[model samples]
Target: MADLYKEIGNDSDYGSINDNSSAQTEDPQTSAPSPSPMTRHQYIVFCGIALAYFADLTSFSLIAPFYPIEAKEKDLSPVMIGFVFSVFSLVQFLSSPIFGKLLPYVGAKFMFLAGSWVAAGSNLIFGVLDELEPGTQFLVFCLVTRCVGALGASASVTAATAIIAHTFPDRTGQMMGLLELFCGVGLMVGPALGGLLYSVGGYKLPFMVLGAADTLVVIINIFLIRSSEGMESKTKGSMLAVAKIPAVWVIALTCGVASTGMGFLDPTMSPHLKEQYNLSPVFISLVYILSGSAYAIATPLWGYLSDKKRITRTLIVFGLTGGGVCFLFLGPTPLFPQVPTDQVWTVIVTVGLGSLLLGCAIVPTFIDLLNTAKWYGLPDDISTQGIVSGVFNSFFSLGAFVGPTVGGVLQQHYGFPWASTMVGFMFVIMAILIVLFGFWEYQCGKGRRRPPNNDLTRQVSVNYFGSEIDDTEENRGLLS
Candidate 1:
């Protein structure tokens, strides 16, 4: 058996020997070395970051199933409810990019603590506000607080993704696949727990639990997490330098659409169900749990496929468009007052609606979109990735902003069907944009601009993914 251990330079950081053969290796047949203790340390911080990220997202997501229930409890209009959710998305949109810039200077530890505290404090406050008032127009305040909370964790997701991506450079897609697994688990578990808590305790329970959990996340980040400590750049840089790269523009747009699609399915869907069918709280909770599972299962498969076939962009186009059709099924059908609440058709309709929402392919498209960010000049550092991710997340935040508020109005005024109906159209638009961007890149040719060995990205599309444009002189010498 191979020794599975070896000595190499610069073991303090989590960098792997890019070319182990040239890294003073003992033998090719020798067993690969176990990751040094520092690597394990990095992994722990990554996991903590993931935990915080997951907790925040899931905390908000869990609200999906309960939206209608809360509406019923307060007799609040759907439009008002939509505004609350959209506010959180909007916060992420404006601040995520800011986190990117602020993180490098303020550091992840500070931002993480800041974000967690914002989330915890606000959640605690929301419970108090909700209990004291009826029709208090507190939606704006709630949203503002949530936005602040979101800003705190704004850069964490992309930061974590970039860290893992660079840590396992050769298997970036595979590692991303693993990352999505954690993401899926967080999303799935968060909503389910919320539903159960709501059923068992009441509306306030979910907020209380999330507030406490988030506070713990802050503590962990402060005490347990260690920074990657990146080296300085060889070349001086500026925004103009990054903007001049065409690939970056294409990636920014592509990621934006993919993110929009992901938002369409979850936080928005629960409210749609509530108004369309006038469903009860417990039932909505069940649906949310189910939907979360769909994402969880679909994401890992998408990552694996993107890795195996390197079909990042194609998958993005396919998943966004295909899964989008599920929203169409959710569009309001005329409701007859005479139809029994327990009619067999209700079950049939439920079965048919959003069915494709959980298929295995969703993860692939999403992974490709995120991977595309790096191709566009996103810094490889975790902190830089956070800022870069914040840029795309702005679009996702846009979707989050739009999905609920618009869906709410349409659902309230036109009925639940119309709210979802609009989302299906957004899906189509996103899909078209993805295809156009990808085709342009393909036509331009895979000149030296692309990494010399970007096989993983190439595999995302079974079709030839690029053109034969003239190679750049800078890349003439070596692999990307």
Candidate 2:
């Protein structure tokens, strides 16, 4: 690590290593050391932040099985139950908009801590809220708690993403991919745990358990994740900065619409399986776990493909169709019993497709857009990443707010099949939007010639225990 300044800071012919020269280098001294358990500090930071992702997804997704249980406990009608799921997203929509204003001022560490407190508190509150007099008010209270907890998570998500990006700015494409990988893993494990645990216990126990886990994770996070730049005195940019970019908005909308699809199925999944095939909640929970597994497996692979400069949006188009087809056809064999008698396999493929489709394409789509946004000048830091991401996520939160309610309506009127169809259409919308935005970005990036690799642009590298993490800048967009 001789002239550390030359490698990380100097924007000379040497600092931003060209593809050709990049290939020539092999020494571990100038590159990020391969991930190993020996790197305990790095592992803790990566895992801590990643666990935060698991916390958010797990906490919110924990409701999937609990939805029916909650509805019955509070004597909630169908509409009231739908409100319970959708209301949380509504709160995310309302609160995320202003978070950008406060994030830079508070810094990512503070933001992560704040979100931890909020999430833990929300869970505690949900576990102990007063009974509502009428209209299943307690049900609404649960949604409210989820929303606030998610809002609190907003800052942490940004912090974690930015911490990685800012720390490994040159390697953001892959690093971010890794970040998503962890989050996807969290998504998988959290739901599986929740689905399994909640089925064994009841609503109150699961909420308390999730709350305790979050509190513990945060305590670890406080010491584990630290910004390379320390705390930036100020993070520049606005929610409007992202909003004003039509490309950005399109990207955001894609996520919003995509999430709407996820939200549609996530809450009502228990009911759908129960009604359609007379299945147990455990079966539904298993489906979610499998879906999450698919996502976790795909995230890192997609990120690597992005580094190779393959076509990310192209992958997305197929994902939408794949996901759409899965949802369109996904259901219990008993629902269409005459078609086939192998109920388990039928459910597996449908749920697998639904899971795989969403996993294969959805996370990458948003990550690609975020990379594009960062190249446009978004700083790689937690609060800034949070605000920028939050803007996109807020749009998604809006869609989430609407998607479940719509699904509930369709289920109320027609049934599970029709409700699932409503979810598929959202993928259709996301695919269309990706086509539009990808086209726009392609044209714009095409107008500019490829700059020399050594050109005076930023360099990103990650070092753990004084070892370097190799991240290249050429891999900017998801498909590069």
Candidate 3:
């Protein structure tokens, strides 16, 4: 049995050797060796990163269930509340790129510590801010503090991405899947925990507890976390250079737009449901849990398919198009005119369906963006990964920033239909742009101009299952 096991392992390695040899003969730089397995130290770092990420997300989301109520007490309007929510994302948007650029120089571990300190400090302050004199000054103070916290949160994210790219460069998809899982868990757990804390001990307890939890994560990073030594890069490229890539710009735009669709709901959803259906914090938490659960479950599946099947482009197009439809049905639209109004059951059903679809759709967008960045002259190295991930994160934060700010103003002035319609329209337009870009890229071979990469060329003949057994130069003509 031991001999048979050895024979099977040898055969597996032999097949990989043959495939690698043939593939490299076409373009030696296009492919690299599969990444090495994780050492015990690497595993420790991974845990630290995951927990830190979870803490970051939890800090951001802990206010989800009760922020609107707190804002209302301070006599804040929906639009003002939107600005308050947007401040963090806006700060994160600006800071993420800076963190990305600095990751290699300062090290991800140091950045993580710095960021954790900032986020935890600001979060603890949020609980007591309302004790200050009320009015516009109070609102300004709240927004300012959240923005500071956003800077810290941005650092944590940048460090996390850099560590993953550095440690598991060969299996970024799988590692990222784990990252997303922790992200979904944080998002799901934060709101539920917040709601429970709010019910039991009022508003300040959630912030205090979550803030302390984040600080604990900071302590872990300081002690257990170490750099992925020897994985550093000294590339001199800038964000401007990455932005010059047409495909990267397109992917970034898609990310921002997709994020906008979800962001529109953040400040508005809790209040809207409370007004429309009178949902308690606990019930409201359930809505977020369902959506987050769908996202968490679908993320790994989508990542697996993209990696194993190499159907990244196909999935992107399909997911975006389908997600747009979900947004339409989510809003007050003709498509779902029959989804009953003035009932808790209606809100539960419609929102659940929309969240599920949105979850499945969002999984493809980031992976493809990360995958496409390599094709557009960003070398597959730690330095380049920092910039690419930063840009990717910045665009998403930009959307998050815009969605709440604009959605608040729209909802306040124009009502739910207008805001929801605006979001749905953005998704539909993004889907169209992505499709057009693919056709133009295919026809002109623009994506192939930079590197000797065959990703765009190979994608021509792939079936939905990702089978490309005949993917070769000879088959390129068939696509034409």
Candidate 4:
């Protein structure tokens, strides 16, 4: 290509050849060279990661529909059930940062494999919990086992995210969206299958199936998935280094607040449905399934839009604003229906719509936040990416931990209305922050304008080998 350019430059009669070549390269009508087999291999690796992610989420969410039922049998209260659910995220939140710091040295592949095995072991134990005498012993065992499983999830999820960021640094939004699609599908399938399986056999069956699936994934990764260490940096970077950035803190806060709103439904929703409408376990799971379906469907669309239209800011602001509104209208108010007696369908429809709106906003927020982290000079290396992934998960897990724990207490005392209102207020505050910080700090702060291309500000490019390189500042500053 360089020789052709030089040859064209030497021709006085074809002075416009250089311009034509440049135009041709940029034109959609022009065909580029076919991708190498290595590119195909990268996609296969992505598939493996997706599968692992699916299994990871399924193992956890599988318990969502029926765990409350199990607790009730043991004479446990809503707060206790919420604690059982919260324990998982609590452990996950604490473990993720440690995993992040270790990722630079251990590599994502190793971390994922180890995590899968641990999670499988924990799920297997959880499956057999019914064998124990029911009561405090049972609840204690459940909490402990779930926390152990969370430890594994922390490792696997953070590593998988880091892997995606490393694999598709240039296309992180699209790839993250694809990952979320898989995860959302897993979340949907977990509850549906768990509920059905529980109806047939028991909770034991769901855990066993998901545990076995994760075990199989570990084997598949050993054989088919390539090493991710190639993308990792030789020297390690500090997690604190990434955390020091103001934008990183902001993004983490946003993710935490958003996650808290979503977490409100976990403990409170199932019980709310059962008590208010006398919904069966299967119907309860269906509610979550519908929400997960919406989430899965919307993720790719948001990702594609962020990538193609450079609408990260637009999506973030819109999603947060819209999600906040949904939360406000989530439960019965003076304006909204309270799902009165014989109004079962009304509650289902309204909650389902809220879930759909949450889906639209949450996934986009994640992609945009991660993209912003990278743009804020979060080091374009695998190790650094891993830390960012861990930090992201940590914040999200923290929110998940707090939401159910607090929301449970609120719902138990006041009702879903109070719980929903609190979550709604959080989203409202986050939306305002996004406009103030997300837009102002990066877009209109001082005298600087946001670059036309989101990545242009970073001046980074990916080579054919999938390595990130810095471009010339002059060339990078050009409008998209």
Model-by-model lDDT, in order?
A: 0.54, 0.60, 0.68, 0.69
| Residue 27 lDDT, candidate 3, scale 0-100 | 27
lDDT of 3: 0.68
Instruction: Point out the higher-scoring one by TM-score: 2 or 4.
Output: 4
The model with the greater TM-score, 2 or 3, is 3
**Tens-place lDDT digits, model 2, residues 198-245:** 778765677788888888888878777765465573444456545544
Q: Write the number of the candidate with greater lDDT, choosing between 3 and 4.
A: 4
Worst 10 residues of 3 by lDDT: 8-17
Candidate 3 residue-wise lDDT, 1-480, digit = tens:
222222211221012112221233222223234446678877887898888878888878878779888888888886688678778888888888888887778766787789889989999999888787767977989988988899888887877776776676556656676777888899878877888898998978998999999888888778888755455655533566456557778877777876776777776677777877788977886786776676666667766555444455566666667766665555565446686556666556656665555544555555565555554435556666777778777888998888877887888897775567667777777778877877665545322232233343333214111344575675454334
Task: Please tell me which predicted candidate would have the highest lDDT against the true structure.
Answer: 4
Identify the runs in model 2 with alpha carbons over 4 angstroms from their true place.
1-42, 63-71, 130-144, 170-204, 230-235, 267-282, 308-310, 331-347, 374-384, 418-426, 444-480
**Candidate numbers, best TM-score first, in rank order:** 3, 4, 2, 1
CA RMSD for every model?
9.7, 8.8, 9.2, 8.4
Clashing pairs for model 2 are 31-468, 32-468, 32-469, 32-470, 159-382, 169-460, 170-460, 462-469
Give the least accurate 10-residue stretch of model 2, judged by summed lDDT.
458-467
Please give the distance, in angstroms, between residue 365's alpha carbon in candidate 1 and its true position after superposition: 6.4
What is the Cα-based TM-score of model 2? 0.72
| Candidate 4 Cα lDDT to native | 0.69
